[model samples]
Target: SSPLDPRYTFENFVEGASNRLALAAARQVADGSASGVKFNPLYIHSSVGQGKTHLLQALTHRLKAEHPEMRVLYLTAEHFMYRFVQSLQTQSALAFKEALRTIDLLVIDDMQFLHGKQIQQEFCHTVNTLIDGARQVIVAADRPPVELETMDERVRSRLSGGLLIEIGAPDAATRRSIIERRIALTAQHMPGFSVPDDVIDFIVRNVTTSGRDLEGAVTRLAGHNQLTGLTLSLTMAETTLKDLIRVTDTRRVKIEDIQRVVSKHYNVSKQDLLSSRRTRSIVWPRQIAMYLAKSLTLRSLPEIGRRFGGRDHTTVLHAVRKVEEMIGSDEALTQEIEVLKRMLEA
Candidate 1:
């Protein structure tokens, strides 16, 4: 009834290659005997629709069910701000503080919205009081603490001090599994509707960004099939979701644009990426920038290298190769590059 309530407990969460480590960490924290056993103030960050809120809610619900005596409070950033503002207006700040301080577990979702100086100050005070009093705090956001722009330094530092975990976008296998799970759930609602495996594969391949997109596609397919008395087919699904599938336009991002985006993301001068500095940080970003430049632009290696501070074509080749390997192996790095690519294209 309510969008399938994504908060699956640890028992229901499907383990896959994409989120095995994160699931383990969450389980450890939830089952920890004393406060701060495995991870205190667990911070989960991910892009939209990657199950961050689901995991946070699941943890909160599981803890409350297991320990009936523990007090838990869960609120989104907007709700938290609203309550804080209302308390100030009604002269009830102390009451709000007291209620929050007495909770055994505090869960905040979409914390990136609370970036104002005043709100951040209040958040810092709340965090300090809860941690000092040995209460567990869990926060979710779209980005990590260090990357949170406009947030107070004290709040950012405190958030980063705890265990920080990031959930990556679902890979092809994970997406396929998600598609199957959603289709099965949909079948429960619509007994006569069915989707073929090829259709599922097609949806997974095309909508490869996030789990939310996949679920939306499945729901749309189920609804259309029910309304029109039509069988779900690959062609129909494609036609229905033409806008959701992102087709890269080679003309949009040029080599120079890629370099500019990468430089800005890393906060390094364009010359640094082009320079012969073998530092790990610079080297990886440089390679990724070059790889994106070559992939997105019509420029040759020599031309791209020349644009990046007169480096040799062979250097550009090496950087491209290294980045390709890293993207295939390192999930976090792949997501970082994908985010940069999205920004560059936008």
Candidate 2:
């Protein structure tokens, strides 16, 4: 069988202001010259489609190319949990320990899924073994250790001890570059066809967040054009991704729905969401929920504020603006918001 390809290597990754630091850090880790590199277990946290997995895979590929003898294994946290569970069920826990112990490098993706005490304990043991043996360990997740409510304290502390890096959403320029790069790749595969610059610009403008969604838009447009024997244009691209572009489609989401979903996800009482608690935990989720309600629903700022515990309309405006700035730069918060969005949509 052919080997699986890395999705977010240096070649395909679009460097931008949002992820420049993270990209540089990954490169440094790969080069083995990063100062105070005691944090061998580099933790990358980001929202889905923000290229966390891509960066992780890229790092692994680079390390393998530079150090082929390094035993590198890249799997999701779910896979880790599954394997650990299977080992116990099959009475082969020793084999699982030995297998993991022998690896020189381990990369686990989507580590937020690694919940439960037993799985976390096993992971802690594996992490300690790797660290004590001077092995490289990298983990990617949707949120930082401190915010992972389902994780055990010991596991969370261990993860926090390592170098924690957050990969934020791409900016406008980065989004444009990503569209261009994907269009180029599509052209290579489709030979006779090409995506116009105007269509690229339209995509970059409308798909204001999430590189994954942007790529999906490009791919969908290319596929639709090819299948229907039609030209790819800005209008057609918009029509193709109408669902994605219409963020304010009230039929799809409501202010009440946002409040409910956010409240449920964070396990915060509806009262707390309505309360003026200004605590980081409450304030962050409240702002995000307010932003979603205003952006996704046709609700007025006053209405959204009323839904979120009787804050003034200005407070809602501030919350939306704050979340907008945060979505551009804060990786962990972005992931949490994305998760809330998915739950609302689902």
Candidate 3:
């Protein structure tokens, strides 16, 4: 049987600007109409707990419902590795390969963990064969295909030649809806176990990490109420979730954190941001890091400058101003900065 989660269907998946494109793409793939080949190998990517797995499983569910006779397989990259090795040990490698090739729809999750040279080659072959035979394939990873640095180049290129959709972090409104949904679901099991508006706002404001964290907050609160018979209050939530809040609080964000996140997000290096290079790629990330340092941290201009390649305070000021000006005009830059901020805060 496939390892699909029954709770993660499209009906329950929350919709927002962050995940709309991913959801739409997933729906189109599930429909498997004339456009099936157009999105043959749909690649959905996002940071952990941003609903990447949920969307993949939702599509798997819909595909199974629409084509009951069709074969569907959902497994993680790690599990795939295990099964491949097991088949080899049991002298059933050919059977494993045959079973995999016959699947009508293949959904692979956590593909970033799909390591090992032989495993990736097999994966690439399976993907190419299935796609060539007009079967559906869907994969999800923490980052885009290009960022799967350890995977085979051929595999990356093959996945890249499909519909790539990124599910960004949920904004405030989306976060609010997620929290309320979690609370409502919890109340279904435990009568009158509700979070007050003020408490909900506090959780939404504090847990700026991911929907998974928001769900954890609600679960934690519900657990406390069930055991302690305590009424949910803002103060109680503050005290109970202080550990979660402390980690994601923006006030605690540091320059090094900004540098690391910016470097990874842009595929640049922390050293590159600190280097004297003047290339557009390097300069843009440096300016963004500097701007984030000024906004998120309390370091003085000179202090921040000292940390980032020991430049002058004036440079930091210029970067802050430059980013501020762009935020008003450059919509992409605005979103990029927002994503970085969420990463740092999380």
TM-score of each: 0.72, 0.71, 0.74
The pairs that clash in candidate 2 are none
Q: How well does candidate 1 match the true structure, expressed as C-alpha RMSD?
A: 10.4
- Candidates' C-alpha lDDT: 0.78, 0.80, 0.87
User: Lowest-scoring 10 consecutive residues by lDDT in candidate 3?
Assistant: 245-254
**Candidate 3 positional error at 215, Å:** 0.4
Best by lDDT: 3
Query: Where does model 1 exceed 4 Å of error?
Result: 1-8, 33-38, 247-346
User: Cα deviation of 212 in candidate 2 (Å)?
Assistant: 1.0
Model 1, 23-80: lDDT tens digits are: 7766665665535634667888877777777776676667777877878788888788
**Per-residue lDDT of 1-346 in model 3, one digit per residue for the tens?**
3477899999888999999999888887777762658887889887778898898889889878878887989999989999999999999999999999999888899998899999999999999999999988889998788757578999999999998888877899999999988888999999998888999989888888788888889999999999999899998999999887765534347677889988998899999899989999999889989999998866678878888998899999999999999999999889888888877766
Q: Which pairs of residues collide in model 1?
A: none
Instruction: Arrange candidates by lDDT, descending.
Output: 3, 2, 1
For each candidate, how many residue pairs have backbone atoms clashing (under 3 Å)? 0, 0, 0
For residue 231, model 3's alpha carbon misses the true position, in angstroms, by 1.0
Alpha-carbon shift of residue 25 in model 2 (angstroms): 2.0
